[model samples]
Target chain A: MTMTNDAQAVLPPVPGLEDDDPPQLTPAQKKRATSRHLAFQGGTAGKLLGYFGMLAAVLLFFVPLYFIVVTSLKTHGDIYSNPISWLPNPFAPENYSYVINEVRFDKYLRNSVIITGILTVVEVSLGVMTAYGLSFLRFPGRNLLFLLVIASLMVPNQITVISNYALVASWGWRNTFQGIIVPLAAVAFGTFLMRNHFLSLPKEIMEAAELDGTGFFRTLFRVVLPMSWPTLVAFTLITVVNEWNQYLWPFLMSDTDAVAPLPIGLTQLQDNEGLTNWGPVMAGTVLTTVPMLIVFLILQKQMIKGLTAGAVKG
Target chain B: MATVEYQQASRIYDPSRPPAVNRVSLTVADGEFLVLVGPSGSGKSTAMRMLAGLEPIDEGTVLIDDVDVSELRARDRDVAMVFQSYALYPNMTARQNMAFALQNAKMPKAEITQQVERAAAMLELEVLLDKKPSQMSGGQRQRVAMGRSIVRNPKVFCMDEPLSNLDAKLRVSTRAQIGSLQRELGVTTVYVTHDQTEAMTMGDRVAVLREGVLQQVDEPTHLYEHPGNTFVAGFIGSPAMTLIDGATVSSDGRALLGPDHGLDMDLPREYAEKTPGQVIVGVRPENWEIVGHGAAPEDGGASMPLTVRLVEKLGGEAFLHCRAQETEGMTASVRGSQLVLRLDHGFKGIEPDTTIHVRPKPRTSVFFHPENEINLEYL
Candidate 1:
């Protein structure tokens, strides 16, 4: 059983090694290869175009934010000058003091915090429970109930404003925190978002939990909720921003400074100062915008991940 | 360990369509391992779920140790399940996952820790205790899943295709491990799989299901040797038994096979009497004996010419796939007109498109009535 060179002598030459020249490719094949190479490298021109598009998007969104910050620091005279100043000259840092101390912005900030905090907590909790029930629980008309939940999303909020205002007014709930918080606490969008995310989770995990002797609530807290942090955080962030910026319903519901949120307090400030005073008003706008901006910046990565949870499989 | 029984248990997901699991009655002895095996849509998993209390038994009762548990919730049934996907808690460490059921049962923390450590040692998962499911390989995660159910020490273990997700090489080793572990535990277990080889090698008794109906339940050797009908005959064995249809019974009481009537054999009197005009002859791959090339019959056995189409050499054995020359112009059987012959490992010199002669060994062929597809010998 000796190995021999005779076998190699009879073996045919490899197909491309018969000649030194590389095998010729058809035009279509050459084109495909070049395109594939370009795609892998992301082509220099395409990379430049992509960067330029991103720059345009940044400028488009940030310009208004830049205008607000600059206007907030400008003096009353500088704001209305003939040559529009893009930068604040002797930055009127006193404008923030005027809005905070003179206009009593602390009360409105307290009201906003209370309303937004309670609303976000209540809405997110209810959303999670409702989504869990709709996705996991067995019932007679579960699909029909889910349909009703989704159908509510199509209804415009403005159409229900009059009825909500009438109902709150009749109960003598005007100018109260409950009046502003109660109606908005029933979350439809959050329920829909959370339900889709829950449905995307493997159904076998819940079944496994049941076989492990876990009740629905324990399973929800221990097994389900731990895996759903991204969506829950996203839902909470959205709810906080929406409730904090809520204007029309609160304006109709609250008549006094006692329960009026920041949005309503901004209008009160405007009414007191008249149209000529722009510095303090811009300062107040910056104050209201900054809190949400900070929140968004801190949690933006998780918020994006949560929003696109079920759109693609990992 | 406890015995489990299904008294006509059925699950109907939709009223208009056929039941997912039709009325299926089976009984498992204490400490026995029974495998429910079928194709993808054959309701094997549904039947196992019904016993686990994960699925509602729409029509009949399922009992554990003589206690009816049809209305019991999954958690109350005291049965553990290993899902096809492993279904380990992605966020929990392996130790935590195995300890979760004990925690829910309100077992003392010290006892839970001891139980988890013991199960981990048995599964060889000591180093993997702190690793999450995502951090472990597929095989490690599977072992953790097995440990989770073993830690429970429930009355019954329901495993739904637990090895289906592993790589081919790993599946074979894990298959042996699971079999040996089940033997050591000696719990009444019901395992579901679509792989016939897995079912045959693992179960003490394998139950074959088709379209939500139990086809046959028997020991592996018994099921392989004596399948009740054509479906079992064609499905149980690898390469499968080639069934030639349009076989007829001559007026002389001889079983005539092939379109040209090239082969004839004496059938049992009871079988020959029951055959209506046509019969189906089933012959296992190993049962075929290669006679000679273009030679006449020597022992008066039926023989047919075959054209070798492919030769598969599997080191220890070879399977020759050939087309029946006699049945060339006839209507093909359910498995087509190809006949497979299993040969010894040293068999050689056969190539594609070469001609050879083969015949079913004496008394090795099973006869079936063409219309009903029932084994005539059984009838």
Candidate 2:
């Protein structure tokens, strides 16, 4: 009945667990460790050099980000002021405002959001469902269907551009978000990735779900899909990035600012004036790259795992 | 609870070829732990899979609680399966993996939590609950797998060599734990394993399968003592039931155990009453006795001469590898200190290459037709 702070600190000693006392170090071990430490002292200089080299390599990776951020914050004048500054000297936050308010950046943003979101949603949803069916469900022609996807991987996207454009145009989807998003859906890449992941899953788990009275959809929803978090994250990244940077398909179909996403919209900054406003163009580029960077950062752990799964032994 | 009735059920793994499991008529009662055991490539595993709805039945029906699940989907079958690989979700923590099925059942979150906690406690998996399959050790992961099965409360539990992946010591302990847990759970369980030790120690009844055919099904003791066939006789025991070729012996049931050596044994009525010709004789190693009252230490068993070869000591008991002078085979078995004969070293008591007389105790000897390999008779 007494709830005192000290008593609260006195936690219940767990049952079936023995307290683990740290191992005692003998004096000889201590001396050996000291000698090892002294040996490492000379190597410390080399280790510091290696650390700086790693630092340089890491900075090498961030150089693109630094360039984008600096360019995004510079004015057209600052961008061409004799030498383009490595960092924003006189920060022109106005470039963001200009892109945000003046340049139909809102339309570009909306278009990018609609196109990328629909593409991601459609591709991921269909990819996972189709892959689960192919990987786990046994039906005739399943292998043939999987092989078809693999075959599609060999066919260049550039080759499909003309046919896809014609099909969308025939359906009168030109200048619409559907024209941009629909074609990007049902991606072979996502299906391939997710299929491999599901196939790698231990069949016993699936059998257990089957015994638990889980139907096909229920098993997929509650078991297979949830366990494929790593694949989902990795495929999501691939899908988002592919859709975000998609230039050819969008540029081929859309003719106006209202329909075009950023990769196409950013081209408008490079007017036919024979000279370029590198500031807003780079600003648009920065805007285009930010969402994916944020997504990748959030899912780095899953990305690494999924990536390794592709090569690791079963 | 489930009473599994496999009436003429068979599994043809490759319909392009012969069936992996021939027509197997077997029934496992509710709460019975029946182990289907045999060497690799035996149809025992295929039979379990058929019961689980994982392997398609080529013929007849598998009735779980008298419901024919021949055409039913695996999910519709009320059986949980445990694989050798454990197969717990590698991505989810043990708790999540265990809860997956209950979650699908749409159990209230609180109920799911309580049931998961209960199963975890029962399996001693509380600490490992937050750990993924990859994070947990083999024994811990196996417990998590059992926890997943426990949460379901399914009608039948089908295990395919679930203890094989564990280290030897862990396997023994886990096998005992699982055996006891199955008793506590009181669910019908069809366990498939190649290890006869697991079958003998764990099963209420053990069924022996070989080459897609059911050999015999009986209490473990009965299987060992009264095997229905030569395969079962040999498969059910360690140092397997020693068999002597009957085709090379005499007509009055006297076995010529070696060159210039012969011993008279009465023909078992079971074999004599039937086809009275050549028959292989079966005897467990323990049934053998040395018959040299005034002979050397190298003497084997009564009437059978053996040359001492290698001896393996296991604390209290030692297995003497004694080669037969009459055949190409060697008798490997446990011998007490009084009976053991070694040539040299710390065990310098017995000599090597000396002829030792031996004989199998009467009535313990089983006779089989060398052609069919089936028991000469069953009593």
Candidate 3:
């Protein structure tokens, strides 16, 4: 029989700190005191430094935007004479009117809105459906299908542009809205994001739905979709912005102003009397940036939520 | 209401390993509540899931009202389940959750609302009908889950450890509520739980399983008094029965006391004849009494020397946890030396580390075959 020494079995105190009386301050108290001291003595200086750093960063981002606004308002004479100046010597609202009147701004704006709207709807709805199927359903070759989808993410759009152009030309979809939207409607990132969100949904709730006699599509629409609005809204915002700012496909595919969006339309403002006119181009650019900026301001909350959906539970 | 039957249903998850649920046959009469009770991985839950058509039956058929439903999907089988998580839809109010099945079946909107309201009233959940699951308490969510099932009015209600998530006091009250509710609804419910107390208190009949195999199926009282084997004998009762082996039969068909030869008791003729070599003796804690410290053993009752280990005194009764020391010629047949005796609450003053002599009440001890551990009554 082996008997262990009971006294020895008791855990020993930390090295060199063994004593009957404990430390005066508990660890939490010590932490509070140390933080307080740091806040009073060092934190003020560090906080000031941080504020200045943030100011610098904010200025770095906004200064270019301010320059664009000022340049857009300046006349061509003022732009050529003093390019770096902040103020538009003669605040000309005419540059905007000129870009609007001379170029098909209304047509291009309408095209951009239609393309972006339809693309966002198709992409998000298709993404959610694909994600639900990928995450919830158990079908043969599911892993292989998901692997193929993920593999597609690694293939750059440029490599497929020629083949896609050939296919579209053969389908006679050139210069059509379908040509612009359909080629890039189902994005891999959207699927990946939505799949992760759907996967994180509690499995019990889904099983409960199944036993409740709800069909798969009904469960997805009624149960899964309603709970995932933040992620979906965020994804919608991202897709809207991406499709709104699309340049290469629209530029190459559209043979006329009918299908071209603002990004392609902006090029028309570049030439004026055989010289590149900075004023109208800057004007068109500023107008294009304003819509997205407002969209971002309104939907930043959902965008952040969607981007971080599975990283933390709501 | 309809009768449910599992005709040798089995679920084999993998070909190389043993089946998760071996061919298990059982039946529940119309409106009867049968409990599948066992420890985890014992296939009790699997049996319930197989009945619900959640787990596919690889072998044999499950019949609902004598119609084979082994090939039917969960929804097509028309059975409702209450999950242990109380899986109420987080986004929906309790009323909507209850009405979901009807809504999906394309029932009229007015009828759906009326049915939901009736189920809500029956569960006393009318006040909580507007609240989502996240806003409700655990007991309220459990009631909502039950309401969801009850609204369906299906042939069978499958409950898988639905009360396990509740607090102890709430579990007790809700257990009573569910038992009475099942009786009132008169729906055939197959309840699965690992709690023997729940199995005993709630079910019309309890079926015990071990290692994916059915062990015994009987009324709770019958199961308690006449367990078919050692597993049930030890598993059924709280403070489990203390089983001792190495007891042999004497020439007169009486059991000879351990090695000390201080005790002799007559074995039941059936036990003596079936167990000729070595026999296991089982004594439940309550069947044991501690006579006065030096009281003489009488009337052929068997006594053993016990060293008191611990005492748990509940106001009305005391459980004396003790260890019995093997005497000369007694081989170690029991896995551990620990034993327990029940004493009246007023009988105080049992101290630790003190030796005392205890005897099993006459005719209360049982015998089992040493090899298979089956009760001698069956052997």
Candidate 4:
């Protein structure tokens, strides 16, 4: 009797049981009891701790963005004051215009748009085609080809920069749009992402399309691609962001502001002499960062949905 | 409509392992409904896939309308397939889904819409024509899949366990609907299923397979009454036929069964003449008749003692599960040495663990060869 009482004390009280009754349960009740015992039941204290951790993370990321905006709106005198100002004392809205006129921000913005546009279109199209070939098309040595594609992802871009620069220079493409966009057009990351998504789609649907008299390219464009909107949007956003902030390859390729992107153009705001104006540089940084931020904000939902697809099933 | 023929078609997935579908040859007359039935891994679905051109025919030729189509692509073969999962396009509306094939064939806009609307009306899916697959229920999606095939007017229809996903009640109604619809359209079809009941009820002629080999192909009633082998005998019936092994023919034209010849009865004259040394006897549940409690048979027939194990009362009829009391000389291959007897629904006063005597009705016992398990009547 005493041992039974001790066992009862260790077990949690079941919902519909009387306090005085012995704990004889049906199979369903026993299953519920075992799952309740094994699962983590977060109480009020754990929930509070979770909220506190989320608050800390939000503050950690938000503070640097706050500083960039505040410094971009501050005058040179306010920036160099003995005590740092979290808020601008004299709001200098002229810094944006000054950077736009003096630093040729308009020309840099145009070049950035043109380069990122062409790069994203080419990269995404090539990635979709390559991924479709790897996944759906049958050929000899197909597995070996896919393995090589995955292997290319492991070799860092920095390792290929010097050789790529030499090739571009030999072809007389230096300081040109082709020199910057052509070398980076073949993206292994986008191909890998799209290949996995394509593989997750039901193979029966593809067979159904084939029975409907659709050829290879029609099936890809009509059936396979229409159902792949989320992943396609995600790949496009990633490609745009990557090409927009690309600094190294573009810097190596471009010798002037004529074909350089936003990241390469941002460096021209900094003076070689020590007495450089800090206001316009910060304003130019803001100008370069905001467009990508807007694009991310607009496409953030689809990006997350695409990345998490196939992780859960109904 | 076109007749379909398979001339030793086979599909081998791996070189070292046995074929997924061994060489099978059969013919389906135009407008005939043929069902392929088997257990899992029995290659029923694989055979139908070969007909649909979804699976490669590694060994032989498949001809539709007297044209060899083994080398034809799936689209070129012009066969319509309804997958087990329905396989509807989630992004397209029901109208678009049904009209997809017509649009692919470059039909005019007016004709595509007209055919889609006609199919939707026939399937009672007029309200669902504007909805996507994700917004529809399972039965609705299944109807859309049917409509998709109907609008194509293809040469042959290949259905792979299409009704295996619905609820029990819905499966019954939809199966009836599909049967009547096939007759109305008079299209040649090859259906695949693992349910013996579905195969018996739906197919004009049923084909049974085992271990990637074709076992028997006959009309439903003929297949039931005359099974080619022990596998079909055991697999066809609901409660399954009980097979008793080690029974032998006596010197006086009587068959002796059980330990010490506890049960003996005269065999039919034709069967007794060809009887071998040892044979296996098969008796279905409905053929067993109750005599008395441990009493001699009044009709001068073979009677064996049975101890009741359990009774299942299923409203209209009751089944008594019994263990043969004198199974000492029976071979080990006899399934559990158990006997099943079907009784009327009003059967009363028979409880578990009671001993009773039962006998097979005249001319109801079928014998099989001991080694090969083939029906001796046919031999």
> Model 1, residue A63: displacement in angstroms?
1.3
Which of 1 and 2 is the better model by lDDT?
1
Q: Number of clashes in every candidate structure?
A: 0, 9, 0, 0
Give lDDT: candidate 3, residue B177: 95
Q: In DockQ terms, which candidate is top?
A: 1
lDDT of 1 by residue, A9-67 (tens): 58777788666777799998887887885654566898999889999999999998898
Cα deviation of B185, candidate 3, in Å: 0.8
Ranking by DockQ: 1, 3, 4, 2
Candidate 2 residue lDDT tens string, B1-379: 9799999988876778878999999999989999999889888888998888888888989999998999998877867888888776665788988888888778899999999999999999888888767666778878888888888899999898999989999999999999999999999999999999999999999999988888899999988888888788878887677776643345544444432344544456445545445556777767766665226334343365566666665544545567655433322222221232322223323345555556676767776666787776753
CA lDDT of every candidate: 0.86, 0.77, 0.84, 0.85
lDDT of 1 by residue, B271-309 (tens): 777877678888899988888655545666446778889
lDDT per residue, candidate 4, A186-291, as tens digits? 8889899999999988888998999999878988987888778788998999899989988999999987889988777678887635776777788999999989
Interface RMSD of each: 4.8, 12.7, 8.1, 9.6
**Each predicted complex: what DockQ?**
0.39, 0.25, 0.31, 0.30
Model 3 spans with C-alpha error above 4 angstroms = A1-60, A75-90, A136-138, A170-172, A271-276, A297-314, B257-260, B264-266, B292-302
- Model 3 chain A: weakest 10-residue lDDT segment is A305-314
* Candidate 3: CAPRI quality band: acceptable
TM-score-wise, the better of 1 and 2 is 1
Candidate 2 lDDT = 0.77
How do the residues A1-314 of candidate 3 rate in per-residue lDDT, one tens digit apiece? 12223558576667878656776998979878878855444457888998899999999999988888898998978887833567888888898998888898889999998998889889988898888889988999998988888999999889999999999889989889988888878668889989998888877778778777888889988888867878888788888899999999998889678989999989867754689888889999988888998888878866565444423211
Q: Write model 4 residue lDDT over B1-379, tens digit each, in one string.
A: 9999999988999989988888898999999999999999999999998988899999989999999999999999989989888888766788998998899999999999999999898899999999878778888888999999999999999998999989999899999999998999999999999999999999999999997788889999888887888899888888888887777776665566843464653356666667566667788899888887655556765567788999887766789999977546533234667778898743466789988788787778777777888887788
